[model samples]
Target: MLLPPKDSVLRQASFTNFWISRILSSTSFQMLSVAIGWQMYALTHDAFSLGFVGLAQFIPMVLLTFVVGHAADRFDRRKIVCLCQLIEGGIAALLLVGNMAGWLGREQILLAAAILGACRAFEGPSSSALLPQLVPKHILQQAIAWSTSAGQTAQILGPSLGGLLYSLGASCVYGAATIALLTAGILTCFIRVERSERKTEPVSLRSVFLGLEFVYRHPAILGTISLDLFAVLLGGATALLPIFAQDILHTGPWGLGLMRTAPAVGALLMSLILAYYPLQRAVGLKLFAALAVFGLATMLFAISTNLVVSLVALLLTGASDVVSVVIRSSLVQLQTPDEMRGRVNAVNSLFIGTSNQLGEFESGVLAGFIGPVPAAFLGGLGTIAVAGLWMYLFPSLRRLRSLSES
Candidate 1:
């Protein structure tokens, strides 16, 4: 009997390695985030301080996004990813040791978390670009969906696991993160990325301007990304979840875990559905409608005090957000030229990462001033208003009929 070609075996190995790395990396990242949030809350009890933690993480990524994007377009992605995973592994080890030694003070943990954010600044764009090299262009959408689903899966389990582990002891959270990172490191060793042609010319500030120019020039790409960014920035109620769990909902760490998992659970289900059927029609309209639903869901969650009701609202919020994400990702992928993909995706990441962290900041800041409940409810209302304004401003997006139109 004839056997599969050697190249086929290599490709399989590479793809398997990539996904395994994704799973482990995601698990560690989520668990670490949960641990950080819980620890910070325990230490400071102030919402603004939690918000500052997010600000610390966002600054480095925003500052370095373009440079990292340029490098992703220029370098061997596998090597870049390997180096990042190694750096992240060391950071996890440091956290583990500090916790074990009873030296993981709040100030030290905050500094370490900031360093972790700096490492992620380099990692995100490079990893985003590397996927296209591993899979065929035909399956790129599916690959993105699958990768997102893996992240959602990690988000679903990691927080609950972190809470359980934290109850055992703070060291347990770091210990689990260490194991996850080691697994990712081992998997990173097996990935093989093909080298592409690179321009011999040196990069400069002018070259970065070209990317900004392209993004501004593309109405569809610019509009979709902007809409999601604004919607999430205004509507994200996740920062207040801990307050809801502890005070309003009358639960503890476990409730926080459920709140974290609720959105991921909905997102994972929506991902599976989209994977099978895909979004082939009225993409932009769908995106607008989804964000509207997301805003409404957030509003409901903000008002509700019951744990089950809050979780249900979060589930719907996540489902709506997934629709927006898939549409925006497809737009970014299909609209860009091959060489410019990294820069555009970098720009895209800036918006996404900013929305998330800054949303946390907004929630925390507003919560401190107006109190958490009113702040959350008002934010959700603002998100809906933003969505309406965006729909009015971008007529082409509201009328968008198909993915191929991009």
Candidate 2:
């Protein structure tokens, strides 16, 4: 049997460094999330306030998507990623200081989140576009799987560690996040990639929307991206997890940490499996099936009051999501032209950021009005509905058999 693709990809120094940086950066972000969620809930004791956190981040990313995508295509992606990490580190430091001095109000946290979102708007496209440059075409799928696994591992560690540190003090969690983010930035600086070759063609309105045009033209890509967008946009249950931890589960920070980590555990396991085995046949059918499972699992989580049951449901949700992620990511990277990868990825990032951050906002608002449990239940149904709708509308997506086929 062949050695796992992860092992092969890791043999290259650049890929290894990039992988390490991913782990560190993901860890920092995860820690920051726990700290922010706990602190915000403690301060305001309102569900809407939690939603506002997502809103604060989402607005800047949406506003800056076009420019950030352009910059990624036009500039050195590594440098852009490094700079973004540095800025995120600064934000973590600010949070640390504010928490220590007791002046970090809800507004200040939201402001920091907005700035961090702006940095990520640039960072997401650049970092995503840089991946294909790191490894051979044959191992790209493995690389994506392993990279996601590393992120999932960080998500597992970060939340638990963050929650434990929160018990010490919110400032302690922020302090740890600051260190992790700065370390990631430093590691990113060591990655060596050639500068992007600039196109001789002058910039024009058409050039600006090229990524959008590509996705519009390719129904397969469009189907997959939009499928995830609408599904997660309506179905994401993460925003109301704090409420679930506190009121529904009747667990404290420790329980909250477990809740956060459960999905990652599932995702990490699934990613490892795909890394070794890979998907060979019936890829599209598998993708749709996984999404349907994710929706069902989410619905299970919504109604469960038992911690163990909720954890299991969340684990299944993460496991199901990994299949979709691996397939979708491969399609996006492999199908896109190198020159347009950055812009296309930026558009994809916009969908992702919208699904995540805006999804959180929607969850919070709905939870405030309708209650957390019902909100989650409704979201799950919406997810299921999207899967069915997309299955009917995008027969091309359903018929997709392999990444290599695209």
lDDT of 2 by residue, 147-191 (tens): 889889997888778888999999888888888889989988888
> What TM-score would each prediction reach against the true structure?
0.86, 0.85
Judging by TM-score against the true structure, name the best candidate: 1
Q: Evaluate model 2: give its TM-score.
A: 0.85
> Which lDDT tens digits does candidate 1 get at residues 1-406?
0112533666667777887787788777777877888888887798887876776777888888888778777777677777777777788788888877777776877787787787777777677777767766555666667767777888877777887788987778888787777778778777886666755347888676555777888888889889988899989889899999999999998898788888999999887777666787777778888988898899899899798999999999998898888788777777776567677788888899989978988999999999988988888898889888988898888888876575
TM-score of 1: 0.86
Q: What is the lDDT of candidate 2?
A: 0.86
Which parts of model 1 are misplaced by more than 4 Å? 1-12, 36-55, 98-108, 169-171, 198-201, 243-253, 365-374
RMSD of each: 3.8, 3.6
Q: List the residue pairs that clash in candidate 1.
A: none
Quote the RMSD, in angstroms, for model 2: 3.6
Model 1 lDDT, residue 12, Cα: 61
Query: Model 2 segments beyond 4 Å from truth?
Result: 1-11, 36-53, 94-111, 169-171, 194-200, 240-256, 303-306, 361-378
